[model samples]
Target chain A: MTTPAGTWNWLTDPAHWAGEDGIAHRLLEHVVLTAVCLAVACLIALPVALVLGHLGRGGALAVNISNVGRAVPTFAVLVLLLLTPVGRWGEGPTVVALVLFALPPLLTNAYVGVREVDRDTVRAARGTGMSGRQVLLQVELPLALPMILTGVRTAAVQLVATATIAALAGGGGLGRIITAGFNLASTPQVVAGAVLVAALALLVEGVFAAAERLGPPWTRGGAR
Target chain B: MPPDDCLARNEWICGAYLSTRRRILLDATLQHVRITVLAVLIGLLLAVPLALLARRLRPAAGPVLAGTTILYTIPSLAMFSLLLPLYGLSESLVVAGLALYSLTLLVRNILTGLRGVPEETRQAALGLGYGPLRLLLTVELPLALPAAMAGLRVATVSAVSLVTLGAVVGHGGLGNLIYAGMNTYFKAQVLTASVLCVVIAVAADLILLAVQRLITPWTRTERA
Candidate 1:
């Protein structure tokens, strides 16, 4: 029975904006969940990708290993974890699933980023008496920063989208808005919730795209 | 073992769950395959023209690419909710949302593939009496297949994963099982459905990989 006008009305209502289930609260939850997942994923994935990329060997193996789980949808992982003992701890399953989901792209890009550094550049650094560690840090890291950032950009945007599943696990996020609306059979409310999440995701994407494009000189402007 | 034993024990891996739910599982998998295939195919269809337009017109490239990437950043739930008004709570909503999701991967890779076709190759084709349309069909498109297929493979796999989110809309293929089972803590049901989802995704990816190689024999020959 709800119409587009109803959706507008629902969005404009201050009643839905000020309580525990308000947009502000849900937005906070979504941001916190996504940030936590991305931070944890980066800590785990970056070092492995960077190191493997520097060594110039086994980068593919490491990336592929992480990717084996890629075929399994993140939501499925979240549900499986919830069905386990891990679900006993609130928010635990969501975190674990999101972290795992974010790993593959982060690992792939970080590894490829560092590996893409010109071979001759590394060789020149080595011939100049730079240690392997120094070359990795001084030569490879800087050039790879843009590509690594590309990975982060990809992971962050995806995490924002995926983190909405946290709401399904009874954790807080914008997804609760939509699910709650569904329970109430309010299509307008549901559309409003969708709008908020989509706006947030696009905003995140825009910010990261800007960061990647306007980053350091080594940042390739396009075609990553 | 008794059919209900696994259910009674709340096991994570249960043969009984599969045996008992075989028909249900098959239906869910079929729905999942249907949704994923439809979404990816629709995505490919949309991507070709967009990629072509982008390559053909330099000014259009930025917007077309940006638009698709922005679409991608919209979280799956949000995307579905946004489309709720248009398609209601049905498989079409899920398919439309997923098709949008696939566009970023599809468009980017196809564009890359198209651009990857060497200028020299185009010149050769033109020199040999190939007009624009003919040149595109025989020379440009064939060269772009490897990249286009790569994109398709990625889009297809991710679609399988994302389709699980459709459970929220009441049509998430295997996601419906996982979603329902999670509510009552049906461990056997949840695990069985998830494993099937993984299997489908992996199997689809392998098939696509084979297709990519088969179509782009020249790529292999060059590598060899």
Candidate 2:
């Protein structure tokens, strides 16, 4: 933990790269935190958004609430949770915090995607004797797939980045390395951690971008 | 003897604790206000110029804007950790990190606003013998201001929340209070900080709404 001027020496050290406590392990932890948070967020947000989008009456309020959620600081929420009875368990608090952090984009995108579907398509489906549920599943869902995927993409990137804050609350991730590096004034560790996080973000963005491209052509046309 | 001992132990300590909690809330509110203002001002100064450069050079703008998008997605705690050794517990680190976070939103909005300006207006400005600067200031910027301000409003609210991350670096904003409360298991302090952060966010949003109204009188007039 000593503050060495040439801390990059760790880069060539086999021991630092080989153990269970290495870069691979940290990345696994990050991925787990991100995945779990996103899964839970989607579970909560998607259904609510779908229901609201179908109703159309409460969509504005739902979207506004989601917008407010976006404005709230993730770390503040994490810290607040950590100070409570829930904080005694440690890891669960981090998961809850990340879920809350990821919710806005998921909800907003789902709602907007459904809301933005062509009125004619919806009208046509209803005209052809499709029930509301059938229209949602058969027609609107396909049309809104691109936007829904885009929201998931946003949530994925956001959750990955924010999972790092778990380090502040003693939850393990790449953020732990970054925070330790800062505490020890070790530039190489800091650089390595930042680079890993940045690369991960790019990777997620690329994956999602490709998925968005592969979505329905009509939605792509609308996007363009 | 038992009653006297219990009363002596609890009452005085509770009174002192309540007063300290009240003081912490007041300090956090003030600190949060300052951090939001500083971050938004600095972010605007940096983003506007970068956006202008992006528009003028369409080829390079894609990669450059992509880089900022990456920056925006980096976790706040991770970014702060990366900056710690060089900046060393300074306000500059927080301000710079928050500004970097705002780049994606601000640049996107600026580009959108500039692109949205009617083609005819630009042609008319050129026909009037106005140079690039004059045309941009007189015709383009005024037209773009509303959209740009929408981006600014988003950035400002984000910056307000992000400044809390500065708490980990030892800067005493609302985040610091929240983190401290969590670390020490102080529920009152945690609640106070959380409430104050939300209040500041809402208040700042209202102020931005007012500023938007002042700057974009046409929007209000149109509404009327």
Candidate 3:
């Protein structure tokens, strides 16, 4: 509400929503980048965490190492990548940087979720003639589902927000709108861009939260 | 000047980045540290009281948690754009935004730590005629230190990286180096700043870990 008139005007303008530089195009770019990066991050992080959690070995070390990604600025990593050969491929560096940033939450959540499962439950599953693989797939994985989803939710929301940095590296995303607004000194346009990003992040959070509620009753909190 | 030789000549390449602007680097690091520490400290202080209030008032917990969670989900770039109109390129906007971001984590951790204290311990403290204030200070806080400290460690790491993004709002730090480096295609500057950001994060995290260990000695001992 800082510049109520200007911000309102920008939000209502049909031109900002209809063309190549319109909100639709930018929103699609942001969504695609977010989805691609998140999918790749999940692919890389989920299996490692699950296997480690299933094996009950080296999970802590892996989690700790991945936490390093949290400490390193994604923007910094993005810039560094942009200077390397990876930058030559257009959006490659940005995607890699985003994937790296998204890893810690997914890895930590999955590992911790698995580790937190009741030992007796595992033992009981084993007693029921379940093999190690069966115990993991049938018991531990189910129990860990909530935590894993929580991690995914966290990463997804974060990626939606942080993906804005992709624009800084000449990659297409909603961040370009804000930066473009800055270049033109259009505060309302910048504000509008921020609103879109925040709204998208909240939308992602809501979807995951709803998914969590609609999940199997066993995975829900208070089920125990 | 081959890529392989550049990688092998580690010191030589690093030296190129540090050849000039030593003063600028030092100043930027100090600014980065100052901004991060200040934001987190303020967040921690604010979160404790809010958390205590939420614990005491059950009806308030839902709203308080939801509000802070929403605040945390706001994308950094948009948060900046929204804030720019109100705070206008000042340190206050960045600190305020980050402090708000830290609250959800810190408050939840504090609440968890407080709740984790055994009911028997609380009863004993009450039976001893200990006042609420005294019991909280001597009994609850010490027990809660571990959880609170864990929250602090995460917040500090996040704050360090977020401070770099504050450069976008003109609050200069190591992020400014990366920002300028990107604009100029200067690998040396980008590399130096990114590495320093990681180093700061890692060092801060380690120090917090040490502090947590020192403060929670009972955690290391078994209850025979």
Q: How many collisions per candidate? A: 1, 0, 0
DockQ of each candidate relative to the true complex: 0.74, 0.60, 0.79
Off by over 4 Å in 3: A127-131, A222-224, B1-12, B220-224
Q: What is the DockQ score, from 0 to 1, of model 1?
A: 0.74
Best by TM-score: 1
Better of 2 and 3 by TM-score: 3
Q: Residue-wise lDDT of candidate 3 within B1-224, one digit each (tens)? A: 56653334433146645756699899899989888888898899999999888888899889988888888888877788888787777888888788877877899889889889899999999999999999999999898898899989999998898888887877758998989988877777788888889899999999999988888899878543
Compute the TM-score of each model's chain A versus the native chain A and list the values: 0.94, 0.90, 0.95
CA lDDT of A53 in candidate 2?
Answer: 86
Per-residue accuracy of model 3 over A16-83 as CA lDDT, tens digit each: 89887899999999999999999999999998998898888887586786677778888888888888
For candidate 1, the docking band is medium
Model 1 C-alpha lDDT per residue in residues B71-98, reported as the tens digit of each score: 8877888888888888988999999999
Best by lDDT: 1
A66-146: candidate 2 lDDT, tens digit per residue:
769856788878877776678788598899988988888888888888898889989999999999999998888888877
lDDT per residue for candidate 1 within A1-224, as digits (tens), equals: 55678878988889888889998899998999999999999999999889989988886586676557667888889988987789899999999999998888888888888887889999999999999999999999888988788788888888888888888778899999988988887889888888888788888878887776676667764235
TM-score of each: 0.94, 0.90, 0.92
Which TM-score does chain B of candidate 1 obtain? 0.96
**Cα misplacement distance, residue A101 of candidate 2 (Å):** 1.2
Candidate 3 residue pairs in backbone clash: none
